[model samples]
Target: MRHTWRWFGPVDRVSVQDAAQAGALGIVSALHHIPTGDVWPVEEIAKRQAEIAAGGLHWDVVESIPVSESIKTQTGAWREHVANWQETLRRLSAVGIKTVCYNFMPVLDWTRTDLRWTARHGAKAMRFDRIDFVAFDIHLLERPAAPADYDPETRDRALQRFRAMSDERKLSLSRNVGAGLPGSADGYSLPQLRAHLETYAGIDRDRLKRHLFDFLSEVTPVAEEVGINICAHPDDPPWALLGLPRVLSTADDYADMLAAVDRPANGMTFCTGSLGALAANDLPAMVRQFGPRIHFVHLRNVRREEDRTPCSFYEDEHLEGDTDMVAVIAGLVAEEKRRKTEGRPDHQIPMRPDHGQEILDDLTRGAQPGYPAIGRLKGLAELRGIERALSHLTYGLS
Candidate 1:
C-alpha cells in the first residue's frame, strides 16, 4: 500500500511539511475552497498540486468533490450538478489525478455527535453517542417523524438526555452534527436541516439506493472515458441517522452498487473505521471481496461498547480496537499482489491512518478532531511494521 495523509489544503492545521515529515508518499485532498456543484477549473487544480509538490508529496487522490444533496434526491438543479460533476472529472483527469473518493450520504457527511469525547485512556477521541443523536433528532432539530424510527425505550432515553442539556449544550450538539466537516458541502442551520430532510420524506432505503444507481448511470461512463475511478466511500458509522436512509453501509451494499453500475470507474473507498464499526461486517473477508474495485483506504479503528448497535463508539488506538488490524492489512497486501498478477496499473492502493486519538502533545497542538499528528504518525508506524513483517515472512508483498 502507498501511505497517504488527508490534508485540508493551505488552511489545514496539519501542514504539507507535516505530511512530508510523517513519511507520507502521497497526499489526499480536495479543492474545498470551491463551492459544491461548481466545476473545478484546471487553474485551481494546478495550484493545489503545486502546493503538494512543494512538500515532495504528490496529490494522489481527491478525497472528495462532494455530491450535492440536490443530486441525491433528484431535486433542484440536478442536471446542472451532474454536468458540473462530469466536467470536474474531466478537469481533474486532465491534471493527471485519476482516483476520486466521494460519498453519497445525505444531509451530514460522516456524522459525529461528539468531537472531543474523552476515552478510558485519558485521551480524547471522536465519538458518535447514540442518545445524543437521538436527542438532536427528536428534541433539537425535531425531525417530523424522527421519534417513530426509535423504539419506546430509546425514545424515552433520548428525551431525558435532551431535557438534561442546557441551551448552550443543545446548540453545541446541533453545531457538532450540522456544521460541515472537511468535505461536507454546507453547514446546515436547524431550520434548513429540518426543511432539507423533508425532501426525503418518502425516499426510503430502496428509493435512496435507486437514486445512487441513477447517479452512477449519469457519471460513470464519463469517469471511465476520462481514466478516473469514482470510489464511493461507505456511510460513516454505517447506519441510519436523523431518520435518513443509508444504502452503502455494508458488504452487500458494495456488491449491489458494483452490480448495478457494472463499470470499471465505479468503485469503493473501503474505509475500515466506517465498515468495522458495525459488528456484522467481517473486515478481512470484505476487504478481499471488494479488493479489486477498491481505489482508496481509510485505516482507523473504533471501540464499540457492549451494546454497540443504535450507535455508541469512540475512536480507539489503531491496533488496539475491535478490528484485527494485522489480519486486515494482510488481506489488503494479498489483494495488491493479486492486482499485480492481473497486470492492473493501480496495483498499489493508497491508504491513510484516519481519525487518530488526541493524545500526548496533540491536545496542546490544537489539531483537528481525530487527526492529531502524533497519533496518526503512531498508527502509520504500526501499520507499516505489520506490512513489513508480512512481506518478509510470506513474500506476498514487497
Candidate 2:
C-alpha cells in the first residue's frame, strides 16, 4: 500500500509540497486544464510531470482522462474523441504514468447537496441529502418521471421543501446538483442539461453498458500496448439519479465490465466512499473480491442513513463510517503480497485518503472542498498507521 495524494495541478491551494509534507509518496492528478476529449500531448503531460517531480513526488496515476459525453453516447465526433483518448493513454504511459483513472458517470461526475455540511464535531464535511436532491430533481430540475423514482412520502417532502424554498435557495440547489467536474469547476444550465438529456432519449442500462463496452473495445488494446491500466471509477451515489443510468455502481456492474473485455488494461478504481454510499455494497468484501483488478484506491468514509435505499450521507473521518476500513486495508495488504509473490511490478497499489473534512486552520486555507490539507494529512496518517499495523501483523515486518 503506497500512499498517494490527489493534487489538482500547481494552482491548487493545497500544493504538492503539502502532500509531501503529509507523507504521501506519489500524486494522483491530471491535466485538468485541458478540455474533455482533447488530446493530452506529450508536451503537456511532461509539463505536469516536471511540476510533481520538483515537489519530490512521483506522478503515479492520472485520476482521470475524462471519458467525454461524445464517447459515451456515440454521437458527434465520438470516434475522434476515442482516438484522442487512446493517444492520451499512450502519451501518459510513455511518460511513466501507467495507471489512468477515469469515470463513466453521466453529466455530473459526483453530486452533493452541500459541500460543507457541518459535522457533529464542528468540522465541515461534504454531504448529500436525499431530500435536498429529490427536491432539486422533481421541483427545480423537474426531470420527467422523477416522481416514479421515489416513494410518495419522499415526493411529498420534496414538494413541500421546494414550495417553501426561496429563489436563492432554489438556485443553490440547482447549481449543487448539476455541478459538473469539480476540478474544472464546470457545469451546465438546466435547459442546456435538458438538451444533453435528450441525446440519450432511447438509451437505458443495457444500452449504456454496450456503449461502455464499445468504448473499451476501442481503447483497451491501445492501453494494453501502452502498458496502461485503465481503472474505471465507480459511480458516486451508486444509483440512478434524475433518470440517468449508473452502470458502474455495483460489484455485478464491475463483473459485467470485466466480462465485456477481459484484459489487464481493463480494471477498476476501488473507491470506498462512493461504493459505501449504497447499503448493500459490502465494501470490505468487495475489497477481497476485486482485489486483484483494483489498480488504484480512494480511501474515505461516508455515514449513510439507515432507513432508506436512496439515503442521505456525509463524508466521515477515515475510520468512523460504516466501511470496515481496517479489513479493506488488510485485504489490500494481502493482495500486495500475492502480487509480489507473482513477480508483478506494481505490487504496491497507489492509494490516497480521499475526501476529508475541513478542520483546524484548513477552515481558512482556501483548499478545494474535500481536499483540505490538514484533514487529508490526518486521514493519511491514520491510514498509514493501519497499513503499518497490517503489514507488521501479516508478515512480522514493515
Best by lDDT: 2
Task: Look at candidate 2 and give me any clashing residue pairs.
Answer: none
- Candidate 2 lDDT at 356 equals 94
Give the per-residue lDDT of model 1 (tens digit) for 182-263: 6434688899888888888888899989999999999999999999999999998799888889999999999999999998
Clashing pairs in 1: none
Give the per-residue lDDT digits (tens) of candidate 2, residues 1-398: 88999999877999899899999999999888898999997788889999999999999999889999988888999999999999888888887888999999877788999888899879999999898899988877778888899899889998898889899888887877777766775788899778788787788999999999999999999999989899999999898888888899999999999889998879999999999999889887888888889999999999987556788999999999989998888889889999999999888899999989999998888788889999999999999998888788555343
Weakest 10 consecutive residues of candidate 2 by summed lDDT = 389-398
- The numbered model that scores best in TM-score is 2
Q: Please state the error at residue 46 of candidate 2 in Å.
A: 1.5
**Stretches of model 1 off by over 4 angstroms after superposition:** 183-185, 393-398
Q: Give the residue spans of candidate 2 off by over 4 A.
A: 393-398
How does each model score on TM-score?
0.96, 0.97
